[model samples]
Target: MNDFWQQCSTLLEQELPSQQYQTWIKPLSLLEFDIEASTLHIAAPNRFKLDWVKSQFSSRIADLARDFCCKPMVVHFVLDPKVARRANGATMAGSVDSASVQLAAAADLTAQITSLNSTTSETSIGQQKNSAAAGSGWSGSPLTNHESSGAPERSKLNPVLTFENFVTGKANQLARAAAIQVADNPAVSYNPLFLYGGVGLGKTHLIHAIGNQLRQQKVGARIRYIHAEQYVSDVVKAYQRKAFDEFKRYYHSLDLLLIDDIQFFSGKSRTQEEFFYAFEALVANKAQVIITSDTYPKEISGIDDRLISRFDSGLTVAVEPPELEMRVAILLRKAHSEGVDLSEDVAFFVAKHLRSNVRELEGALRKILAYAKFHGREITIELTKEALKDLLTVQNRQISVDNIQKTVADRYGIKIADMYSKKRPADIARARQIAMYLAKELTQKSLPEIGELFGGRDHTTVLHAVRKIADVRSKDALLNRELHVLEQTLKG
Candidate 1:
């Protein structure tokens, strides 16, 4: 049984991401196997891991058992409560700390979810100088997985939303790096750490990660992670209850404040006033504050100019849509967590059609998984097509090089004739390159064909344009935004 489990682990290492294997597979132990009954028993370190292993690895392990026993087998996973009692003895307690492999492999991936653990550093908050937090019901102990701080006020942070689990790519590298720096240094690094992006672009995940990291590092630091809507509600309740003093004390004394979807504060005058006071108080005391929104701080309408200026004062990073390769990695990681092996071709098919955000890409993957399981069929390109025919139909519009050239030209205030003519001016050349890049990205045309469409230029010229735009888009925020808008326009 032990040998069988090891073989299964080895096999899975080949099929799943390395982080998935280390985080989910290494902790499992084989307890028993009944040859005649074809039953295999597996032990996980704790309940959290037991459930995850059962859902994410049981099927694959059962397949290995079948191979080992020369027949079908049922894989059963359970937690040893004894192991749970001995924190040092459990595999989970050592999950992030014990692995011999360097974690940079996992850290480089931008993502969403619970980080396996945090890389903690120095704290800037003085040790509980504000006694008002205790009286205002804001003081709390450090958090443990699945359990709150055991104080009157709950932070409402998901224990599983950490940095280790987030898969990173070109799309969110800057945002993730800034989040880590804030997590490690707290008030000293990126005081506000303004994260802006479209919906479901991992802004909430990154903010939660910062809070969780702070909780682990800064003992007795008052921390709160709340949505803008919830903050508004709290303001309303305080007004009704005449508890403004308590609210002020509670909000102003926090060592770390993580607020999500700040756009929700727009048009709410009272909430804005309250939050402004809290923000000013925290910043004055050198406490960390992190905010997330659907757009840049300057573009967030209905907010005060003073508040906007304050928001822009800190480090602001946009979490853009994950690129193609990043989208595929996300799909594979998600499937691996669900105990399925999704092939690259099918991932590419789904990724190409759902290019807006991580949430939509995940929705597409879930549909395909559900459709396959419902019909008792293998997941393949054909099955993916059948599952997402509606999405495919919506995205099936043909975007040609001519259309791209015209679109880019109009947007950049250049003539379409310049796309084919030898126009070397910076604006015209830039627009031409952008059009070529879009043509390659949104259409199925070959490089040579795309080149020929632009005044019979060589394939290398087209390739150079694609490479230049791709490289620039990652580093240049303005150009990245322009490309993002153009792609959306063409797709829409």
Candidate 2:
């Protein structure tokens, strides 16, 4: 098996550019092979890489494995650091050769992997071979072997945020589950997981968790975790430095590419153009790309329609604001992490009052904690109320149905009277429905009150319009953007 892998390595060396092979393929170790079952177990250094390989080159690997091993080989790439460590033994002190350093790094990474999974094996023949490899100074660069020979620095990922740490609830369970399945095997179920929600709603967390899990599984994968903002920045930087080739090289070489805050890319035309090419490159390679944003991809204003069309070509999940129970759980978790104790009642009180945003909710808890600690007093409902008095006052400000109707009407180029008219014309009816939807969504108005204001329509009519608008907003980018704009106008 060792000789086979070395032979395969040599084949890959000839097939791929030096940088790519070094960066992605060099760290991989063949863990087990079942010729009868046509199964080959391979270990990757991280989940990012596993996702990359599975998305970008699993077929290629399978084809190569069959040709090399003279059988139909099913490559199972796992990101098991322990396997790598077991395959590559400890590094000797005072080793300066590049090969020795890689072996040492692989060994150290493997040890960390084993520590992460204690029930795994330690002593193995592969470890001995890795030790020998370390001593022989055979460390070759993995970057040169990539399909895209121009890749720049690899992306940095946060190790602490994995699938385990992400708390799932009614609001995020589906998104969490989808992310897990995607991480476990990219492009199998949901090729592109589109996670959308308001800010700080755990979209980034879910995608990062996927990356972490894949890495933990030890798949020799090429994973790229980036923010759309960073992508834009990189494109701009590349333009300024005349390094567009470098930019293309960095982005097009991923098996799994996770992008966050995609809304930031909506307005930049040149950036969007570059991203479109990058997107095509990854998708063409069958790589999985997960994106998260405060709004749906279609709703992202100022983006090219073609780019938006590509974004809609997969499953879309929305991470809603945590329900009351989930919010309380979040508060408790935050308190625990901060080493502060809070009674259940206090936690619920904070959760209920600060339902607007997750960041705001956490900020409120921190403020209460800080004030209580400063005053040498225990946390109580009364103290919590006092601490959040200003926020509560702001939340208590009433938004009227009439105000929402006027706001929607003004924004949509419709007469305010049209909202109360029995107009069956497409534009008028749509405008009236939007007014009703906005009233139901933005104001503290009952369905009956909203209907009464909209030409004596029934509460059910208002409810139906709200539901229809919500549904349409999910798939209709223009409608969603208009609705968002109307909501912002109303809030302002």
| Best-fitting candidate, scored by lDDT | 1
lDDT, residue 339, model 1: 80
- Tell me, what's the RMSD of every candidate? 14.7, 23.2
Task: Quote the positional error of residue 277 for candidate 2 in Å.
Answer: 1.6
Q: Please estimate how well model 2 matches the true structure, expressed as its whole-model Cα lDDT.
A: 0.68
TM values, all candidates: 0.68, 0.57
Per-residue lDDT tens digits for candidate 2, residues 1-492, read 887788888887787533345545776788887888889888875444565556545666788789877878888989766634542222212111222333333334434433433323234333533543233212221334433433345676788777665655545666776676566546545657899878777888888888877665544566778888778777777777777777786677566789999888867999889888988887766667899888767667888999888888887877766654456666766776787666645665676556555778888898898888888877877888888888878865746678877777777689888888888898888888888877765554567767888889977688678768766865675676676567555655
Model 2 residue 310 CA deviation (Å) reads 0.8
Name the TM-score of candidate 1: 0.68
- Residue 419 in model 2: lDDT: 88
Which stretches of model 1 miss by more than 4 angstroms?
Answer: 1-155, 398-403, 442-446, 487-492
Tens-place lDDT digits, model 1, residues 1-492: 667777888998886555556556776777888989888888886555576567545666777889888999988887765675653222322332422221443454433211322223222223432432333323455432312222125466787878877767666877888888777656655778898888888998888887877677656667889888888888887788677777787778677888989999899887898889999998887778899988778878999888998898888888878765566667777876788766545665677567778998889999999999999987877888999999877766646678889889999999989999996999999999999999878875667778889999977688789879877887787887778678767756
lDDT of each: 0.74, 0.68
lDDT of 1: 0.74
lDDT of 2 at 105: 35
